[model samples]
Structure formats: C-alpha cells, structure tokens
Target: HMTNLAESMEADLKVHQKPSPVIVRDALGIFLSILFWSNHRPVQLDNLTEQIKTLEMKPLNLEERLEYVLKRGNTFLGFRQLNELVLEQRKLIAKR
Candidate 1:
C-alpha cells in the first residue's frame, strides 16, 4: 500500500510538479491507520519514531513536511509539540 501510494504520488509529481492535496491527505490517513493498529506494540512505535526522526533530517518541501507531521509526528510527540513544529515550518516557508 505504501509502495502504491508512493508510486501514485510520484506520477502525480511528474505531471503536476507537486502531489495533489488529496494524495497527501490519503497518505497521512494511511499512516495514521497503521499507527493506530501498532500502538499496542512499544517496539513498533519506537521503530516508527526512529524512522520519522531519520526522515526528518532529509530536506523536504512544505507539503512533504506537513504530511510527515500529520502522518508520524503524533506517534511520538504531544499535540503542543506537533503544533509548534507546524507553526515553525509555516514561518520558515513564509520567509521564503
């Protein structure tokens, strides 16, 4: 499912230069669903958080960053922390 989503998003990017918002939303929704199902497993949650932290080091566009937060941020971060991260990203984008 994640592979298919990535392929679809890549195809959309090839044609539109950016992923459609619907695709981003769907991807985030899928991530959230997986997170929900894995919540009972502490090891899985830690692995996912580590994955997110590693990905966070890569340079991503605003939409990708937003998707990252929506999809993975809540897994390890409180609402306030996530909100702060989003706001900080928005400010950075606005500066550009």
Candidate 2:
C-alpha cells in the first residue's frame, strides 16, 4: 500500500509542482495507522489548542522526509506535528 501511495504521489508530482493534500493525508494516515498497529507510538505531543492547529499538504523530497523523521518524528507527533512537517517540506522544495 505504501509503495502504491508513493508511486501515486510521484506521478502526481510529475504533473504538478506539488502533491495534493489528499495524497499527503493518505500517506501519513497510512503510516500512522501502521505505526499504531506496531509496538510504537509513532509520535508524541504536548498541550495545544485546537484553534492553533492547522494542516498543510506538500510534496516531499527524500532529504525532507529524512529530516522530518529524524527531527520531528516522535511518539508524540500528532496532527499538528504532521502538518508542520508537511509545511516544512514544502518550504524546503520551494527554496530550491
């Protein structure tokens, strides 16, 4: 499923400058779902207000993905963290 998702995202990118929110959401959702099924928590998060939360979908390069997993991927990473990571990934590509 992941392979297929990745492939579909790649195809979308070939047509546009970025991937759609649906793609990112699906990918992340699948990843988190898998993580939940595993013995790990996937990510971590502290207190936060829902009003301050937001979600962004963006295309990801290999480097950004690695950085995200290394820098932000934690057991507490929730929707907000994922959204931030997506925005960061978009910024990284835009700057290039």
Backbone atom clashes (below 3 Å) for every candidate: 0, 8
Q: Please give the range of 10 consecutive residues that has the lowest summed lDDT in model 1.
A: 73-82
Query: Local distance difference test, per candidate?
Result: 0.46, 0.45
Q: Give me the candidate number with maximum lDDT.
A: 1
Model 2, which residues run further than 4 Å from truth?
40-96
**Candidate 1 regions off by >4 Å?**
41-96
**Candidate 1 TM-score versus the reference:** 0.39
RMSD in angstroms between candidate 1 and the native structure over all alpha carbons: 12.8
Q: Give lDDT tens digits, candidate 2, residues 17-62.
A: 3555666667676654443333233332232122113212233343
TM-score of each: 0.39, 0.40
lDDT of 1 by residue, 1-96 (tens): 655655666665556455556665565555444433333322233454455444322223434454555655333232223344434544544554
What is candidate 2's CA lDDT for residue 68? 59
lDDT of 1 at 14: 57
In candidate 2, list every pair of residues with a backbone clash: 43-74, 43-75, 43-76, 43-77, 44-75, 44-76, 44-77, 45-76
Model 1: pairs clashing at backbone N, Cα or C within 3 Å: none
